[model samples]
Target: MPNITGFLFLLLLLATEGSLGNSKNEVSHGSSQNVVGRPLGNSLNAWKYCQLGWSTYERRCFRFFKTALQWIYAEAECLRYGGNLASVHSANEYAFLKKLIHQGAGSAVKTWIGGHDAVKEGIWLWSDGSYMNFRAWNSGDNQPDNYKKNEHCLEMNHGAVQLWNDSPCYELKPFICVKK
Candidate 1:
């Protein structure tokens, strides 16, 4: 379930973003109107927001790239954009990401994320160095069993259901990048 605060914040962000005038995404952080029946002039608007084609949440910006690329190549592309290949710390984040991709692709497709255990077996870490405290691994038999011990990268399955699965880094897939 989505948090009420987060849901309200999303609505506020959308409403604010939709009202983008000639200035675009660089407006100073402040509220010209109340958000969710309360002033949103708090710390929530204190940081710089996202750029064009990016979505902002809690001051972070995320963009979904439709180009399919290998995991390493995808990470490189994300780096070029001044960010990482994206990391998920909670179910809310995971859901938000899935929704982000769906808004881009309009269909289910395996997408690369920033998780891997390349350094050691069973030791997963986000490419951006975020803590790997959440796992949405597909609940399939022997899922992410390091199939043939060659799968070290992570991909999210977004469809009627969303879940994570391990795959080889060489696999090409579209990816999401997060500017923290």
Candidate 2:
């Protein structure tokens, strides 16, 4: 009977410790607080802000657009909505964006991603303060066509699925942006 009691006590202690560890991790991960009337750190938080749009899982915001636009205009629009164009950092993010695009959320036109070659004519950067690591450009695109010299904007053509083309900064198109 003494051994049985000791075993029960050990199990209880372990259960308690596990729960405590989960709570601590949640708090430290910056996902314990609710934002914009939605619970944080869940997929629902992504959909709660906008209708069927792209969501930044870590920062907590949904990006929306109906068409494509110039990089400058897209950035400005995101600012107006308290966010910026979506910056994809992982393969999961790339897949998610691709799925969103395929779902007709952005079916009409090629949308502007958050990347640009604006810094030094060839160096690409995302809007989220990260260096470009992954690219999804189309064939023969982003080849520095040198059409206008120093053109620095990027767009994802849905048809080609791997094309990224550069265009003038002033031309209007749809874009994605993120915000907290």
Candidate 3:
């Protein structure tokens, strides 16, 4: 039938295209086993060069670390991987990250983000040195409470949905890392 022939042709075309990789970038199923020997066209091409377990969204690759570590140590580890702690620039990004954390780490686990007031009390900033133009802090009188003047690192998944809280940087917690 013509339909069967057309489908076979389409498959052939896809196989050819996959064999000839694009110069821009190749998107794969996020694992070497899926990508290493396969033709580029065989991939879904979601985002170029995204490693396995790393989610690609908005031209960035995000990976959530389940290992608990101090805020400073977490930042260092992200840097080692050629990225930094995840920074939220928009509500959509925040929401995406919130879902990612909850799905990857769980809703009950507290996780450290990039925001911190370590340089100065009450002056929160992201690890990338960006000022806080967006606010998602927890409800009043509790967060950024600077308990004993020591709580300075920012974290999410505190009690309510996606609220943030200020805790001491020394506390060990899982973190999110981002790469572009």
The sequence of per-residue lDDT tens digits that candidate 3 reaches over residues 9-68 is: 999999888776663444555444343222233446543455667776676778899999
Provide the clashing-pair count of each candidate structure: 0, 15, 1
Q: Give the winner by TM-score.
A: 1
Off by over 4 Å in 1: 1-45, 158-160
For lDDT, the strongest prediction is: 1
Q: Compose the digit string of candidate 2's lDDT tens values, residues 116-167.
A: 7777777778776776777665555445453568557776654555446666
Report the alpha-carbon TM-score of model 2 versus the true structure: 0.60
Model 3 ranges with Cα > 4 A deviation? 1-22, 25-48
| Residue lDDT tens for model 1, 1-180 | 569989999999988777763232334436542212111236543554455577765557788999999999999999988899999888988888888988999976789999999999889999998899998888764457799989999999833456888899999899999986
Error of 3 at 85 (Å): 0.8
Candidate 1 minimal-lDDT segment of 10 residues: 32-41
Cα lDDT, model 1, residue 10: 97
lDDT, residue 110, model 3: 84
What lDDT would each prediction earn against the true structure? 0.81, 0.63, 0.79
